[model samples]
Target: MIIASEKKRVFIYKDTQLSDPSINLSKEAVLNFYANTYPELNNATIDGPEIKDTELHYKFLSTLGTKG
Candidate 1:
């Protein structure tokens, strides 16, 4: 019988899906790594680990919003 090694992880930023991080890293670590590329993530919050098709999905919700 075959067993899955690790669950796939995907990070959503600005409507863009980013999936290129080591599975060893924790959810917070993954966010910090991408913070360099997307400074906006600094003030962002982690959304969910919503499971879909055996894949782990995470979304970086930006704290910055327009004041109308």
Candidate 2:
């Protein structure tokens, strides 16, 4: 996999072959892997336009307690 740093215009190539199933990692180990890899993005913030429509998209399947 290839990862690019948009700000720095730097790129990195990852070797997928090295990630064999024989090598097992714990949850903490996996989290630490990502933490150490991208220290800059650890606590990044974002600001964007808020979502206007706060509605449920799907219809409710059951109304067991509803009264007419």
Candidate 3:
């Protein structure tokens, strides 16, 4: 039996000064994906992604039968 492991890469962004990140997909690349494969997007333009800030609340349960 023979097997090969795939290569892995990591990128760290420290100070590009971008308020947000615009990752790999460029205009041409997105247009290509929209034209060729993903018709269900309803001809949407290739705008960059959006991130929403949401607050999460969690309660920790103590073993003493109390909520912490």
Candidate 4:
């Protein structure tokens, strides 16, 4: 999974199981699973200083989660 903050980034990878509760329903789980499947997202360049803020970060991630 790719997890980033203003000062750091993280990458994780694993085989995802469709039966896993994390994969079965949660959008957060889906995003995390995709990130885990593709760790290169850890290298993505986030645009704007606003995106670097922790609150905005979660808000943006949550938007993706809720939207899909």
- Backbone clashes for every candidate come to 0, 0, 0, 1
Ranking of all predicted structures according to lDDT, beginning with the best and ending with the worst? 1, 4, 3, 2
lDDT of 2 by residue, 1-68 (tens): 99854221111212211121122553234333444554532333222223335421211111134358
Q: How accurate is candidate 2 locally (lDDT)?
A: 0.29
42-62: candidate 3 lDDT, tens digit per residue: 334333232323311111111
Point out where model 1 deviates above 4 Å.
1-5, 65-68
Better of 2 and 3 by TM-score: 2
Is candidate 1 or 2 superior in lDDT?
A: 1
Q: Write down the lDDT that model 1 would get.
A: 0.87
Tell how far residue 61 is off in model 4, in angstroms: 8.7
Model 2 bad stretches (over 4 Å): 1-23, 40-68
* TM-scores of the candidates in the order shown: 0.80, 0.23, 0.22, 0.24
| True-vs-predicted CA distance for residue 25, candidate 2, Å | 0.5
lDDT of 4 by residue, 1-68 (tens): 99864432221223322223232434344345555645553333322223342322221121222333
Clashes of 4: 1
Q: Model 1: which residue pairs collide?
A: none
Write down the TM-score for model 4. 0.24
The global Cα lDDT (0 to 1) of model 4 is: 0.33
